[model samples]
Target: MVGVGYTLMCEQTGPKELVEQAVRAEQAGFDYLVISDHYYPWLDAQGHSPYAWSVLGAVAHATSRIKLMTYITCPIRRYHPAVVAQKAATIGVLSDGRFTLSLGAGENLNEHVVGAWPHVHQRHEMLEEALQIIRPLLDGDNLSYSGNHFEVPEAYLWDRPETPVPIAVAASGPHSVALVTEYADALVCDNPDAAVVRMYDEAGGTGKPRYGQAAICYGPDEDACRKTVHDQWRWAALNWTVKAELPGPESFVSASDHIRPEDIAQLVPCGPDLEAHVSAFQKYVDAGFTDVAFVQVGVEGQPMFLDWAQDELLPRLREL
Candidate 1:
């Protein structure tokens, strides 16, 4: 489907602007809206962080027809699955049954809030454990759950929507993909390349919904687009994905380990043409993403951004 998601770039966007953008996104023909879940924005990176749940509440009222979701909420870190279940249930009702909970264990940067649990694969393990608790609870329970990572006593959501909520898992590996295939209603991937799509299908996922995401930087001058992208996205350069070409976070870190400030110049594109930007998304569709979201690269071309994407790409993609 034609969906839109934002990464919560703390640098230039905030909750208020996010709602405004969401309103426009829906009016502009977007069917679903997803936002990233991060406790704090990277200080050396994008430099802006707002509470995601509060922002989602605002979005629920700001747009009437748009579906809201966490691109991937980290239920294994700070918040327990029960808490997430409650919050997600509230949002689902508030949105008139239009909320989906996209779950993930968490990441090193967000979960590594020193003084807290310090581990890499803990979130994944916690995720599997949490799901076992969550599915039962969502099916209607007021009982306590005692898992290794999280424990609760008689916690329950008295106010839940009538329809059963769908959980979309953000899976990147074989085990996690299999977990999503077996348990989750949908699966999400950031890259949505051919190989990434293959992972889900190979894991035994049939016609389940799978979504993909990518960012685009289109402007008048190619040099300007690349420069702006590098300025704000230098942090992404630090990400491990650039060099190793592997899907893990370590590869992102490895790429960042060797990436110079100028390296992103070649990696990110600067196609001022709307057709080119739309073509970028076609790769995702060809690779088999049932849903695709685009993070607009820079703020300079906001109007041009919507004008191009909505008119040229959205109509054709709205059918997906």
Candidate 2:
């Protein structure tokens, strides 16, 4: 069976509320929870960006059964790979082997705050170097390493779980898919694009768990859900290239100023129709994603969505 997951979007929800939701998600029958690690919200209207690591720590204690993971963290900038290893190890220990570390090349939106963002090629190279240091350290290996993009002098994790944390890499294109096949134990994507899975499998990710994220707006009124998605998640309708380079929420708002609610309605699964939600999830499962995470776009209706999902959507998705 494909595992169903929930996205804990730190960019929209406060830390305390996120933890409370994590507990609720566990009770709602989610197999796992993936939290976004962001220093800033993608849009100002989203209104929140708490430190994800601190929130994950609280979640570790608050929920006992649900799996925990970083949807994607960029260790190339704003953080050293060694520090990421420490954080991953600590969370793994806290969650008792239920933590996963998902990584990416990162975006200028968050990393630019630390310094000038590198070119796309350079960032990928940096991520490669970062992973070289991170993977070993997560396994409790002492590493003294020097690479073109990173340097570490005898660093290791002392609090690692008995099982090393699984490392998943996010990839939206051929180059990144190649990286995932080469290094990651799992693959993650924001879209249910079949090309990604096909490339991963042809390149040797056949049996690995593939995670895909889908956006949904669950509410009683279809039009209201569409409006909410437009108000909050229209940033998603922008091309990935645009999203990677924009430096702040204001930039996102300005970039998406021309977007309309109908555009979001076409992209995200909207409203109370159980089939709409189930069919949306089916796209990911059909594309061979072993794990699918639903990103409920708006702030409200989490409880209603969860209850509805447990009662209706999940069973239908399992049938698919």
**Residue 263 of model 2, lDDT score:** 85
lDDT of 1 by residue, 112-168 (tens): 554365355665678887887676666667768787877887777788888867888
**lDDT for model 2:** 0.91
Give the 10-residue window scoring lowest on summed lDDT in candidate 1: 240-249
- Tell me the deviation in Å of residue 168 in model 2: 0.3
Clashes of each: 6, 0
**Worst ten-residue run, lDDT, model 2?**
311-320
Q: Write the per-residue lDDT of candidate 2 for residues 128-228, one digit (tens) a residue.
A: 89889999998888899999988897896889999999999998888999888877799998888899999999999989999988889999999889988
Against the unseen true structure, what C-alpha lDDT does each candidate score?
A: 0.70, 0.91
Residue pairs in collision within model 1 = 10-48, 239-252, 240-251, 240-252, 240-253, 241-252
